[model samples]
Target: MVPVAPTVLFLINEHIATEALLGEAFTDHGFDVETFEVVPAERAEDPAGHVTFPDPAGYDVIAPLGATWPVYEPALRDTWVGDEMQLMRDAAAGGTALLGVCFGGQLLAQTFGGSVARSPRPEIGWCEVTSDRSDIVPGGPWFQWHFDRWSLPPGATELARTADSSQAFVLGRALALQFHPEVDTELLKVWLAADSNGEALQAGITHDELLTRTEELAVDTAARVRRLVAGFLTYLAGQPRPS
Candidate 1:
């Protein structure tokens, strides 16, 4: 009998950037991917209402995606966000590999006794990241749309950084990135439409410009994500399992 592919559970915080590009990469690498929308559209009126999460121990991998809400908000910490953090901590303790992106990365840091706070300047749009380990986590003009940043977790190795913030880090079987490598043009359009706070406008970001940039970097971004996922899998393989 053919063995089942390793399962990856994506903890999607909102509808903005669903696992569009990254999900495809996981499937290509022989893993079955499933997403749990923490805040479904039906619950849009009350985002934190009646949320539920799956058992992290059941999956071989867990990836928490980005969210609109800030990770340090007291109200969120009192609700589903707190619950999600506990889930992440438990998953990590159980040796499940984690891939955190954007807000998700912040979650990983916060759960593992690191700190997350407002950046000196919010990083939006494409920006180049510097990495010593370029072959694994390449330096890039990568997509970034976040207002907050995280300090490295205890015992985590800093892999990449930009002038403004630490861009990526790894600990055990987990890897976290401050940028949205999972995003595609379609996802960017949704994010632009949902910008109720005029964040993009204030940052001088227009839909046409973002869309055009995404179109221009489509091939490169996809290739980068593929390499990132491949590197993550390699990293996970090298981690010692809890005995």
Candidate 2:
């Protein structure tokens, strides 16, 4: 019998920040991908519109992408954040693979009893990362743009880190990354044109420089992201399901 293509459910918080490179990587590995926007475009300006998450167990893999909204806001937790966290917890417990990026990583950490808070120093643009398991999580000047960091969930193994924060961790079938291996120059442009431009400038990074750097690193970055996704799939396949 022919096997069905594995499906990846992407929880995209903003229209501008869809799967990008990582989605391509998944497709290359024979997975079908679909996106569910938590914050719909019609309701982009309204906080009330951001209060829903789909059932994560339906998909073979769950990928929660970056978000402009802070994951630790009390108001959010009282509404959608709590529900989303619960969904992630359930998904992990059910043996669904999770690939969390930036804000999504914070959500995964929080779901596993870890915590997210404002970092003393926000990491923006390209920064160097140190990785103990370079085969799975490579050391790099990975793309990072966030004002917060996670403390990591209990029993999660730290795979990589930078001076300012923990960069990557693994717990069960989940792999959480503080840096954005998924972003491409096009996605970065959308972010720069939106609210993140000021933060980029504040970090002493300019749009032209960022775009130029992205152009220069495109080939290598794509290769790296592909490797990470391939490694994640391998890891997920080897994990024993909970009885």
Candidate 3:
């Protein structure tokens, strides 16, 4: 049978800048990607009101980007009501790939029987991740921007880590990343300027610091991200289903 084009769904909660950066990454990979920006009724509350689940049959992959976890998590859970956990459960079970970045990563874990809660320290600026599973993730420092962290769900493989938190997890064809490997210098500037992260800049973290670090990050990280995407695609390709 001829393979169908892989269709990917993107669930975005942050404003245009973040989603645009990530979308560019997806487009670069040659996947057919569709996106939705779930606007929360309250930035700090549940996003249940804005929750949306399009026909899963149409997409081979699903990606949820970073946002206020409080808002996105409830919405995703409430979208399924009694079977909230099954959102990811069913996806993984059916061989559909899921990639969650930062807040989205937390949601993926929470939906898959893991815990997502506030970290002891908020890792807001550029940082690094240690990779015990270097075959799956590149070692050394990776970028981070989260106040929360996740414990791996049962049967999940942890592909990346840092002193601060668990960085990445893989269950079947699905993967979740705590750090922002998708980020670049331009995106970094826009994110720093955004209201959601303005406090970090005002607290003496200058744009220059971020730009310099992200540039250093891009040097090695682009290859890592490409490898990760290819790895995930390989997993999806090996799935029982034909896509």
Please identify which of the two predictions, 1 or 2, would achieve the higher lDDT against the true structure.
Answer: 1
Q: What lDDT score belongs to each candidate, Candidate 1 first?
A: 0.87, 0.86, 0.68
Q: Residue-wise lDDT of candidate 2 within 29-116, one digit each (tens)? A: 9999999888777766654433556777678899989887788888777677787888888888888889899999998998898999
Candidate 3: stretches off by over 4 Å: 1-3, 16-25, 40-50, 71-86, 195-198, 201-204, 236-238
Model 2 CA lDDT for position 48: 45
lDDT of 1 by residue, 137-191 (tens): 8888899999999988889999999999999998888888998998899899899
Mind sharing the TM-score for model 2?
A: 0.95
lDDT of model 2 at position 130: 99
For candidate 2, the per-residue lDDT at 180 reads 96
Ranking by lDDT: 1, 2, 3
The lDDT of model 3 is 0.68
